[model samples]
Target: MMKEKGLLIVLSGPSGVGKGTVRKELFSQPDITFEYSISMTTRVPREGEVDGVDYFFKSREEFEKLIEQDRLLEYAEFVGNYYGTPVDYVRDTINDGRDVFLEIEVQGARQIRDKFPEGLFIFLAPPSLSELENRLIHRGTESSHVIANRVETAKKELEMMNLYDYVVENDQVKKASERIKAIVVAEHLRRERVEARYKKMLEVK
Candidate 1:
């Protein structure tokens, strides 16, 4: 039997859209074995963020060197912070026939979508701006100014939803997670690509 091909799934969403919760759900059932592609960033790790787990934290100089060496598969600057996807990890995972998941912002998503046109992309969206605001406020992780800015930014992000291959409304965690998982399962069963290859074997001798 031929080895399975790899899938590169790009996860994009606004800041307060509960993308992380849905991602946790997507990985919970163990049906899909995907490596969480670790992103390299110049930004300092947040409180409780672990090295190599939350992100591949690097010094600004080191990140610049990587950029200069063309070692990044996709990289973008957001609000004065640098974020990049290392090519080696992604390349290795894909070669191993394991799907890789990239959780990035809209700009990075656009870059990836353009580079790999066939890559599967899903955008998580809040049910409404009000609900998004409520969730952000309740998180209690940011100050009023940051919260206000996030809300304003989310409006712009939502406007770009059409660019994604799939838009998942992330309101109730359980429902949204199932919807995302359904996409993966359905993709596995899609008949267009693999069917043709299997046809030769199944044909009459």
Candidate 2:
């Protein structure tokens, strides 16, 4: 039997939505088999963030050079920093039959959609716009003005929810993670994903 290519699962949403939180929760599960695709970034690493493990930290010049070479699967500029996925790593890993998960912004997710239409795209949505704003404010990492700007940008990003294959509301971190896992399981069982393998099995007999 031929090795089946792995699934590319993208989790994205508007700014201030709990995408990272939900992704972290999902990976914490013992039975999770997906490989987390480490994204490359030009942003300064936060405290205790290891290079290559948390992100492939690069200089702006180096990141731009990769962009010019088309070596990135998807990339976007956020807060004056470049964040992107490495194309070769993702391709090779998926070809090896290990599902890859990407937690990224909506803009980067859109780029993935254009390049990998068959990939599973999950949109993490807030319970309400007000709730999203509250979450952003509670984070307290950004100034009030920055938070306001993010809220505005989130409004526009929310409109792009139609581009995703599934919408998981981040009302609660654990519940959202559970819903995402269920979606992945369902995607694997999708007829198109498995029919070809079954057909080949019957033909062999």
Query: For candidate 2, lDDT tens digit of each residue in 1-205?
Result: 5667899999998888888788889888999989999999999999999998889999999999999999999999999999999999899989998899999999999999999999999999888765666776588666778777767867775788989999888889999999988998898898987997678778888
TM-score of model 1 (CA atoms): 0.78
Write down the TM-score for model 2: 0.84
Candidate 1 weakest ten by summed lDDT? 196-205
Model 2 lDDT at residue 134: 75
Which lDDT tens digits does candidate 1 get at residues 23-141? 77777767756778988898978999888987899998999999899898889987788999998888788767678988887788888888778778998887776566677758876
Task: Candidate 2: give the clashing pairs.
Answer: none
TM-score of each: 0.78, 0.84
Q: Give me the runs in candidate 2 sitting further than 4 Å from their true place.
A: 129-158, 203-205
Worst 10 residues of 2 by lDDT: 128-137
Q: Give the top-scoring candidate (lDDT).
A: 2
Count of clashes in candidate 1: 0
